[model samples]
Target: MSTTFWIIIAGAIATYLTRIGGHLVISRFDNIHPRVEAGLNAVPAAVLTTLVAPELLNAGPAEWAALVVTAVVSLRGGLMAMFLAGAAVLILARQFVG
Candidate 1:
């Protein structure tokens, strides 16, 4: 109906095509190369770094406390535990720090 709507539709179609194309290509291969598999495994860490690095530049006490707790939890717990601990610390710290 509008330019923005058309742009959103185009983007959705593009995203779907890329996802399907990747799946099709991967399915055709009998086995993946170890290097490629390692690269794929590293994607999550790279993406997380990209997301968190910028936030650290503008973080406050609450954010720092959450990050510290998250790091500590990550060293000895599962992902869910780390996330929950970080979120709880952030919320509780904000209540007092703000």
Candidate 2:
């Protein structure tokens, strides 16, 4: 909409180009450093731990209730039921609190 918007668009383009260029440059390798490979291998577990660790560490009573509902819904009917159960919890909480 303005000069700053254009600059942001250019920045995004530059960032995308750098990402593609980096992958093209690095993926050409026949062999890579073992440490680099090991770091890459740990990335998935690291991301999952970071995402779940906060919830696990700081969960309160309400969170425990939600977690129990989510687990049961997920086990019985997968993600859809879990989402519905979460919405139900929020609505029920609002009914009592508000």
Candidates in order have lDDT scores of 0.95, 0.78
TM-score of 1: 0.70
lDDT of 1 at 74: 96
Backbone clash count, each prediction separately: 0, 0
Tell me the TM-score of each prediction against the true structure. 0.70, 0.45
Worst 10 residues of 1 by lDDT: 18-27
- Give the Cα error of residue 93 in candidate 1, in Å: 1.4
Which residue pairs collide in model 1, if any?
Answer: none
Q: Could you report the Cα RMSD, in angstroms, for every candidate shown?
A: 2.9, 5.0
Query: How would you encode candidate 2's per-residue C-alpha lDDT over 11-80 as one tens digit per residue?
Result: 9999898779858877799888999989978988899778866886776555656667777788778778
- Candidate 2 CA-lDDT value: 0.78
For model 2 the local lDDT of residue 82 reads: 97
lDDT of 1 by residue, 33-93 (tens): 9999999889889998999999999999999999999999999999999999999999999
